[model samples]
Target: MKKLIKKNIVIATHEYATGFPQHLRSYLSDHSSGNVLYIHHPLHPELREGIGSGYEWNSGKKRISSRSTRPVTAFGIAFFMKSLFLDIWWTLKSGKRWDAYIGVNNLNALAGVVLQKFGMVKKSIYYTVDFIPHRFSNTFLNAMYLWIDKLCVKQCDETWILSPRIREGRHRVLHIPSSYDRKQIEVPEGIWLSRIKQAPFSSVSPHTGVFVGVLLERMGLQLVLQAMPKILKKIPDFRLIVIGKGAYEHELKRLITQLGIQKSVECKGYVEKFSDVEKIVARCAVGFAPYTTEKSGLTYFADPAKTKTYLGCSVPVVMTNMFHNACDIE
Candidate 1:
């Protein structure tokens, strides 16, 4: 039998509405035992008011003490600079050298590579949670993003991708060669039910459809909402449920009102618990993920969590194949 070895791992990443870093933190705690350091960066620095420090550090149940930064009021370029500074500064002061530094996005991953230069980490893992050819509308910004992506790919000891299709993008689009190891795609773990409980609702109809996750326009939920009228005509009492909220909420509500299909649609804006989401999806007939393939969107290359969530519930998904892990889901 092979002897099991343990190593301390450090994870540096931003926290978005999706709560990806939190999920990852939980997963690591449950699966591994070395001294794991999780650094939480500000999601929106521009919104964080006046000298407040959004940068935080945690290892298991213990919190590391650090002074907060006067968050930059300006977003975009300024925010990127802030994120880079925080990533390096905190890791440098974290007291112990990490065996592996896992950075979730390209920017954070680039920070890990830099730390490897300063001898702070033995291995730097560029863990890409999302990928897209044209991530920014601005040509220069998009080019810069790709440049950093490639830099991280080459500098990091290993690149941990969520989907294999990301390799295709790296080769054909970003031009990274195939010689690099193509293993280590962390397929999301299976769900472990905390408690056997039904969704708060009475009973969901078989004709009902559900969409869950951060409500982004790129998700293509509008397409389903626009077509709900035609769907109701044929299927009778066919209803569609929107189970999250985002910047698109107002637009969704406006369109629902305009289409006069308000009666057939239920917008259940952001249910807080994962168990609640699980229960709701399990009872639904189908899950919608009609991603907007017309343009460059993060979902095109990221292994979407909702797809797994739906399948976990035994609910079939209706999604775009442009996604990186779409084939696996199929």
Candidate 2:
């Protein structure tokens, strides 16, 4: 009898709870019969538990601590070093050579690059989900980040960008070097499509609006809040439902109280399950993706999972012009 070989695959990512990483995990778990090892920097403490064959490094605390400018740059350096050390440690401890190593961001991709160079991993894949030039407040640090990103893209066997806008705008315009031909760089239509539940389209009440995903400053929940009074003028019974949590939660709540629109908005906090989020969104009249254009360059190119989730629930989206899909809404 011939023995079946299980290819060893390693995935290193800074985010695990939501967005691309979560969908990637689900897809790999379902489709691949190989032994998959997930090395993730847990953004949420609750998601520290390993998924599939996985390991967690508490990258969340570092991010939370690095609120200031200097500390943010320091955190980036620390993250790169920590990820590299963890990758080396895992490679040594596992005793099995990795057939492939997939990195979700520049920091994690640095680790994959080193692993591939050392012959610990046969192939490397750099997944570019977001491209923000000024991610770090310090100019030097931001330049360093860009250099690292370029190196990751150049060294990796395959590069996968989330949106066509990014592939066209950043990759083509910036002229990043790649190993493979056109087939090497792939732009997937939707990362979360497999996990999305197919349900009948249900019309929502005109006065209700729903916003789902991470409640960050760039997400433009504040814009939604500011527009609430105007929306109320047109539709007196307008109510907005916010489902997610982030650093901007306190500010959002404060704004709600200050605007005297507390009764008109409901902050659902973080829903543990995506199914629950879908349930809440399904009852709303329109889905909101009011991302701020000035906040980040990545916003213009990002294929936000929240948009997909909203559409999956059959909710009409009211997003800003920054998003690539926003043009298609009309």
Candidate 3:
């Protein structure tokens, strides 16, 4: 038997201890022999205790959670700049030469480019999980984000996209010639290793549905609220469990109140633990991922994590037709 050699890897991401990056960190820690340095954002006071505070390093697992000490609005330009600088500084100051540098978003991808350019990293991989151009409200910001995104895709050794639609858009629509290879890796919201073990808990109730993702207007949550009355007419006890928070939260709450379905709807806000999310999904009869068809809509050209999480927990999913893989569900 031959022992596999470990490769040194560094990951730069803005999301701190959540989503695909967290899953990737766990995977690398368990699989690799070399140390994995995860550069993440600062934690909130609640998340600052027990495995959340400071750096968490196991026998071979090492992570560096760094960012601006001052409070900044989440996903704002200031936050992005602060996170970028911290990641760049730590990546350079680590002293250890990384075999592979992986960046999870646009800002981190730019940092990865700098690391590669400066010879600090042998190879750079851009893990583009979302399209950022449509995320910005300002035109100049959107244009700037697109430019940086293109540069990262063109210069990185490998580009890993979350969906096939994004790849098509990059090649045929965008016509951005990539100097490197591109791969589509669909990273689900939460990993489910033992579906059978969890299946027994996934009891279906026709009157209940679950929506487990960011509560954004682009997510077509309004449509869900609009249809709630119709759903209630058919199933009087129809309940909607919303298990995430975002910019559209206030609007969603107002709509729920206006529609008089507030009693039937339960907003769980944000669940930090993936296990807790799965447990909630398991009890629901169906899952909702009603992404819109707008140009900025994520489902128009991406694999939604909520859809996968629903199916992973053996709950039937109700999503829009725009989702590329939605037809395959039946």
Whole-model Cα lDDT of every candidate shown, in order: 0.74, 0.69, 0.71
Name the best candidate (by TM-score).
3
Q: For candidate 2, what is the lDDT?
A: 0.69
Give per-residue CA lDDT, model 1, range 1-330, as digits (tens). Answer: 011125677778875444456665666665555566776665544333353334445454455554566655666686777788878888887778888888888999989989999999998988888778988989999999999999888888878777666777788888787676453455442444443354433565689899997676888899999888889889978988888777777888999999999888988875757777888888888999888885355776677778877776778899888776677788
Worst 10 residues of 1 by lDDT: 45-54
Please give, for residues 1-330, the per-residue lDDT of candidate 2 as tens digits: 011124566777766346666665555655555666667654443323332223632121221111111111223466457656776667556666788888888777778888888888898888888878677889898888888877877788877887666656555545764433453465544535444454444555667889987777888989989888888888889898888777788899999999899889988777777777777777777899998887347787677777777877777888888877677754
Runs of candidate 3 exceeding 4 Å displacement: 1-5, 42-75, 178-190, 195-204
Candidate 1 regions exceeding 4 Å error are 1-6, 18-20, 42-74, 181-205, 234-236, 324-328
Q: Is candidate 1 or candidate 3 better by lDDT?
A: 1
Residue pairs in candidate 3 whose N, alpha carbon or C atoms collide under 3 angstroms:
none
Winner by TM-score between candidate 3 and candidate 1? 3
* lDDT preference between candidates 2 and 3, better one: 3
Per-residue lDDT of model 3, residues 230-253, tens digit only: 999989999999887777889999
> TM-score, each model?
0.83, 0.81, 0.85
- Residue 112, model 1, lDDT: 94
